[model samples]
Target: MEKADPVLERLEGQIAWYDRRSQYSQRWFKWLKGAVLVAAAAIPFLAGIEAPRLLIGGLGALIVVLEGLQQLNQYQHNWITYRSTCEALKHEKYLYLANAGPYASAQDPRALLAERVESLVSQEHARWVSAREEAKKTLEKLGP
Candidate 1:
């Protein structure tokens, strides 16, 4: 496939980076919560007392709070990605319309416009695929 336009490539890179970072943060939080829960559950066995119950309860509460915060952060990140993607698409459409005649054929204006629109649509689709692949890789790196 042809290389993506530089501007689009940069935007995609930024979005991918942000997504990877968010996923990493989420994974870390999950691991931390799991570790805490495991430790809490083991406390009574290790201490030979009823401390496990208290520890587990406390850790559960902490996990709840952490989950809430993580959810909020994910929400905010999603908003940012949504806005950025929309803005980028809008700009692509505008550029397509502006250069329609030049990029394709001026002899048949409607045909040229259609061709430009198709090209932009294809580019957008490819970008989406690339972004998704990047996200999948990042998620994989974070573990299952």
Candidate 2:
């Protein structure tokens, strides 16, 4: 059996972390989309007024459509990223497990593996935090 390359193993770990993160991000997008749809549906009733009522309703509807489209685009992008990452990780994991029989266990190797995993986890956390911040900024741009 072929031995797993450490470089490939590390890449796989990173990819796996990203795939999970993408799944979570997609869920958030879905929720946002739903809220947009509900707001869009209520625009007419919510805008009940004589002056600028129709204008307000139209603007609300427009905003909802735009937000929904943006969320959908983000969702699609995340899915594509997630799929590619998952495939890479699976390939790397397969190779790593297959090659484990040959390599003699060493303290240094174990430490390296632990560090790699930790780094991947940290990177994923940072990505999620960045995403949240972006979402907050977007919301702020939309309004108070």
Candidate 3:
């Protein structure tokens, strides 16, 4: 049995992790959005049924809280960013394997490929940091 290339294995693992994360975030974002919408739309119906003020107000507050969490987490943004990074990494890996594109000229294709993957991951991290800071600022504007 031929042993797998370590670099290829690692790159494949990273891709799988990112893909899983992206899918999870996408699913949860959808669920959160649907829940928020349903709860919000139910407020009027609840009020019409003479539901307690607390009940109606609670649903309204729930909507606001759900929306706030969604904004703060930025799951949708992460999903896209992570997926993009994953694809870029995969592209680099394949290019290196095929000795195609820019990798075709590299004397040390493995090193070059590793560098490219690290760069892409670093870019994704930078984006996450910037996004978190932006989200913090937006939350501050909401005044605690």
TM-score of each: 0.36, 0.44, 0.88
Estimate, for each residue in 19-39, the C-alpha lDDT of model 1 and write its tens digit.
565466556566655765775
> Per-residue lDDT tens digits of candidate 2, residues 20-129?
86787678677766777776666665666443777666768677676755653566456555565566455535544554522235455445444545554565456546
Model 3 deviation from native, Cα RMSD in Å:
1.8
What is the C-alpha local distance difference test score of candidate 2? 0.61
Clashing pairs in 2: none
Give the residue spans of candidate 2 off by over 4 A: 1-5, 44-73, 99-144
Off by over 4 Å in 1: 1-105
**Candidate 3 backbone collisions, by pair:** none
Write down the lDDT of every candidate, Cα atoms only: 0.54, 0.61, 0.87
State which candidate has the highest TM-score.
Answer: 3
Separate clash counts for every candidate: 0, 0, 0
